[model samples]
Target: MREWLKQLREEKGLTQESVAAGSFINRAYYSQIENGVRNPSYEVAAKIAETFDINPARFFAGKISEPFTLALKNAPIVVAHCDLELKYTWFHHPHGVFTPEEVIGKTDEELGIYKGIPELIGMKKLIIEKGMPMKKFIVFQQHAGEKTYVVFGEPLMDESGEIVGAATVSMDVTEE
Candidate 1:
């Protein structure tokens, strides 16, 4: 996969279909790039970058890690990760509800809102320190209304099995 704009798309809360609509490539091809199943050519990556209003080189600078499981194309999810210092490193795809910036470079305590703060804090701590993976359902109350999300968190481990960061995947389960 291209590893370029997946995280960015998640950040901007843009769906594959919407982002690829007017671009040269289609949603399937773009999904291939995002899923790490194929790599985009320089021209393709550049064209895609142009459509997203980001510099082409931005795609080349960093690689987006494929977390536990990628949400289906246009799937409602908000994924995030934090470093050892507990600063938000990756915050993307907020299911069209929560603010993306609320999680970026900020801790749960820092946000000081959202339901199940203690559970989230403990989950993150265990993942970052002990490399535990967890999955559970949680309810969050927002000004819009209350929604339940199936949330998963795990330690982002390195090649040596050392914990580096904490990763989270959240899918809205209110309908379920």
Candidate 2:
């Protein structure tokens, strides 16, 4: 399925019917495109993009390279995506004792995993607000032990080039 398309639609607070109406396409056809059951023609893609006010190129930019995916999975790093509200939307390879379920849809402060570390939260906010990339070394002290991570974050932009969120990759640097 086009997960990114779904995310964009949800972010815009649009329904399939609304999008179809706006794009001059059938709702079922739009549903098929969204569910990956059917591929849209370039014309159709352009129409949908126009409806969303995004570039048609976004439709073709959905897939990540398998090699990059493999590299991230094999590396000792945690990757996450957070919306402008600072709530986690996607998390992978969590470190420490936290699980994905505990992190998703929650803020760092809400999870209490990075409590007393306002810098980490502030960094995410800065990236989103300033639309810039940032990197820092953060140390977390838990009951289990102390762990250090080199965290890198960049702003996520939407079709009109507005910052909508932040994406982060944090590699364990304690052993390094």
Candidate 3:
């Protein structure tokens, strides 16, 4: 991803200092990002993409296939996988109420949280039962608070092509 970003900047005849200054980010930070010494935050990526007149999603093309943990280290999102029973199996919490250990074997219902999102419930059901993938925007409401998220969910298939679970990559969109 760093290489791609650098290549794009070079192709655009843009310099690190100029791009960073224009994008309202520090030149040193941008330099580090280009040099592969540090990963850019999602916000920084968006700003840089905007400066280059590219959609941020398009700018990040091919980046999502990178290791989720490495790619999402500074992203305001959570990536999680759940069994067909809706029991949480694993999660990467960039920002979330639940921790890795907290929800490993429990459902949100069991934790008394984030259960008010009808859209998410339906999407998970579809993934588990019909092996469908979903890209959805949802507002999750728990008794404590509410947060908007853009969620992507896909069925996890077993060796025999049977759906065994669901994987979700959700970004917090409340600030946006």
Candidate 4:
């Protein structure tokens, strides 16, 4: 429990004081909780979870090391991981919308769907700067038709422990 709190707090780049300020807990009290000297009530737990944008259940999920479980079948979605140079490293096309070859070496500017979405660039900037995940709903139209995608972007870190880029997964949620 202590390790989880420490790891998450560090990953978020927040000091105890900062987290306390955002959570309305005293710095010393938060320190005690993180150090295992104290256990927070349900109200405090909920507040902490909200302040961190974390699912409180995750802390007690127990023995489940995996942070997420997602299906990548023929689900009409496109997911991609990009390097700092804006080159794609990995991609998953659940709907067969576009071939991997088409997006592998291209930046967002070179991609048809994202070419003019300045908001996406802003989202990337926010994710990279804050080292957190962001989600938004986007509309796009292709040869087939128009669709709505629930896009999520999270910072990706490299070996030396520095954020290099991001991993994004967009799922089509429009009703057919």
The candidate that wins on TM-score is: 2
**TM-score, one value per model:** 0.54, 0.58, 0.56, 0.53
Best by lDDT: 2
Over the stretch 112-153, how does candidate 4's per-residue lDDT look in tens digits?
545325666667778778889999887766567767778899
- Residues 59-142 of candidate 3: C-alpha lDDT, one tens digit per residue: 343465358667777888887778788866566785566666565555767777454455776788888987888898888884
- Candidate 1 local Cα displacement, residue 112, angstroms: 3.0
- Taking the tens digit of each residue's C-alpha lDDT, what string does model 1 give over 75-146? 777777777777665667724543544455457787775776667777788777777888878777766687
Candidate 4, overall lDDT? 0.69
| Residue-wise C-alpha lDDT for candidate 2, range 1-176, written one tens digit per residue | 87667767887899999999999999999999999899888899999988876556546533433455566656778888888888776667724467654665568887775532577899999999888999999887767677788899999888799887899988878883
Which regions of candidate 2 deviate over 4 angstroms?
A: 1-70, 94-96, 113-116
Which scores higher on TM-score, 3 or 4? 3
Q: Order of all candidates by TM-score, from best down to worst?
A: 2, 3, 1, 4
TM-score of 2: 0.58
Candidate achieving higher lDDT, 1 or 3: 3
Cα deviation at 117, candidate 1, in Å, is 2.8
Model 1 accuracy (lDDT, Cα)? 0.69
The local distance difference test score of each candidate is 0.69, 0.78, 0.74, 0.69
